[model samples]
Target: MFDWLQHIADWLVYDVFNLSTEQHLANALNFFIYDTVKILILLFVIIFFMGIVNSYFPVDKVKNYLSRHKLYGLEYLMASLFGVVTPFCSCSSVPLFIGFVRGGIPLGVTFAFLITSPLVNEVAIGLFIGLFGLKTTLIYIVSGILLGTISGVILQHLKLERYLTPWVKDVLAQAQREQHLFEAEQLAFKQRLPIIWAEVKKILKGVIPYVVLGIAVGGLMHGYIPEGFFEKYMSKDNLFAVPVATILSVPMYSNASGILPVVQVLVSKGIPLGTAIAFMMGVVGLSLPEAMLLKKVMSLKLIAVFFGIVTLCIIISGYVFNVIL
Candidate 1:
C-alpha cells in the first residue's frame, strides 16, 4: 500500500540528491520523507472522519447518554471505546475528563476514557497501522481498551469519590442542580462540513509537530543506531525489561503521533515489541503533564492511585505482548 511512498523517497534520496544507498544520511532522509508523508496522509483521513462522527454525536450528547444509561458493566467498555475514537492527548483529555465528571458520569468510567484516550485514539490507530501493520494495531487497540476498562472498574470499586478535591465536589453539586440541555437545532450536512473541516485542520495542527519530531527521531535511529543497541537492555531474555521500560517512560510525554515512530525504531533494533510498546504506553498514558492536569480536579492521593493502577496495567500488558509477539 505504501509502495509509492517508498518510490518517492528513493527518488528524492538517490536521484535528486545523488546520494548512494550506502550513505547513512541518505537512508535517514529517505526514512523521514516516506514516513512523514504516509503518516500525515493517514492522520488527515482518520481525523477528518472522526471529526464528522464527533459533530453528529457531539460531546453533550455523549455525556448525557453515558450519564443516563446504566449499560450494566459495559459502561466502562463504552467509555474506553469512546476514548479510542476521540483524538485528545493525555493532558488534553483531562478537560473532557472533568466535563464527564461534572456531567455525572461515573468517576471510574471517566477514568477508563481518560486512560485510553491518550494511549490509543484515531491518531494512534492510524500511526499504528503505518508502523506495525494491521495485526499489531488490532492487538494494541484491544489491549488499550482492556487496560482502561480494567483500571476503571477497579478504581470504581474502591469508592474513591471522597478523594476528589473540594472544587470538583462543588462542580458536581452544581451540575446536579442544572437541567439537561438538549442539542441545538440541526443543520444541513453541507453546513456541517465547514465545522468538521475546521476541526480536522485543528487536530492536524495540534498533532503535526509530534508526528514530525517522532519520525525525525525515528529516522536518525533507523539510519545511524547500531542494530541490537537497545536489545541489550530491553531484549526478551531480560525478564524485568518490560517493567523497567514502563517505569522509565513515565517521566517522558508524547502523544501517540510523536512516540509511535520511535517505537517502530525500537522494534527494528531488536527491543522486544512488548517492552517498546509498554514504554510508549507509559509515555503517553502516564505522563507527568497528565498528572499535573489531573491535580486540578483530583486530590494528590487520587492521582497517585490512578497512576498506580495504570502503571501496573501497562506493565502487565508489556509482558503479555513480549510473550505473544
Candidate 2:
C-alpha cells in the first residue's frame, strides 16, 4: 500500500536530489517525507470518519448515559472506550473532563475517559497501524483501555470526589446541562458534511504541527542515531528501564499521534517495545500541563494522586509488554 510512497521517496532522494541511499541526509529526508505524508493521509481519513460517528453519538449522550446508568463497573470500561473515539490529547480532553464533572458522572468514570482519551484515539490508532502494524497496534489499544479502566477504578475507590474544588461542588448543586444542543439534529448526512468537514479541518490544523515535528525528530533518529543507542538505557535487560522511561515522560507533553513516530524510532534503535510504548503513554497521558489544567477543578492532592496512580499503571504495563513482546 505504501510502496508508491517509497518510490516517491527514492525518486526524490536518488533521482532528483541525486543523493545516495547510504547518505544520512538522504535517509532522514526520505523517512521524513514518507512518514509525514503517510501519517497525515491516515489521520485525515480517520478523523473525518470518526467525526461522522461522533456527530451521531455526541458527548452529551455519553455523559447522560453514564450518569443515568448503573453499570456495575462496566461504566468505566465504557467511558474508556468512548475516549478512543474522541481523538483528544491530554490537554484537549480537559474541557470534556470538566463537562463530565458538571454532568454528575462519577469522578472515576470521568477519569477513565480523561485517561484514555489522550492516550489512545482514532487519530493515534490510524497512525499506529501505519507506523507499527496490526499486531502491535492491537496490543496498544487494549493496553490503553485497560490502563484507563484500572486507573479509573482505583481512583474511584479512593473517593477523591471530596477533593474537588468548591466551585465544582457548587456547580454540581446547581447542575444544568445544555441538552438542547443536540435536540434538533435530525439533519441528513449531506447536511452534516460541512460541519464535519470544518471540524476535520480544525482538528487537522491543531494536530498537524505536532505530527510533523514528531516525524521530523523521528526522521533524524532513524537516520543518525546509532543502532542500540537507546538500548543502553531502555533495553529489556535493564531493570529500571520501564519505570525510568515512564518517569522521564511526565515532563514532556505530546499527543499520541505526535509522539508515535518517535516511539517507532525508539523501537528501531533497540529500545524495548514496552519501554518505548510506556514512554509514549506517559508523555501523552500524564503531562504537567494537564495537571495545571486540572488544578482549576481538583485540589493539588487529587492531581498528585491521579498522576501517581496513572504513572504506576503505565510502568507496570511497560513490564507486561516487555514480557509479552
Q: Write the per-residue lDDT of candidate 1 for residues 117-191, one digit (tens) a residue.
A: 988888789889988889999999999999999999999999999999886676544333222211254666677
Error of 2 at 124 (Å): 1.1
For all candidates in order, the CA lDDT equals: 0.76, 0.78
- Candidate 1 TM-score over all chains jointly: 0.64
Model 2 stretches astray by more than 4 angstroms? 1-69, 176-232
Q: How many residue pairs clash per model?
A: 0, 0
RMSD of 2: 8.5
Clashes of 1: 0
The alpha-carbon RMSD values of the candidates against the true structure, listed in the order shown, are 8.6, 8.5
Give Cα distance to truth, residue 283, candidate 1, Å: 0.6
Each prediction's TM-score versus the true structure: 0.64, 0.64
Give lDDT tens digits, candidate 2, residues 157-202.
9999999988667544432221232337567778778766775576
In candidate 1, stretches whose alpha carbon ends up further than 4 angstroms from where it belongs are 1-70, 177-233
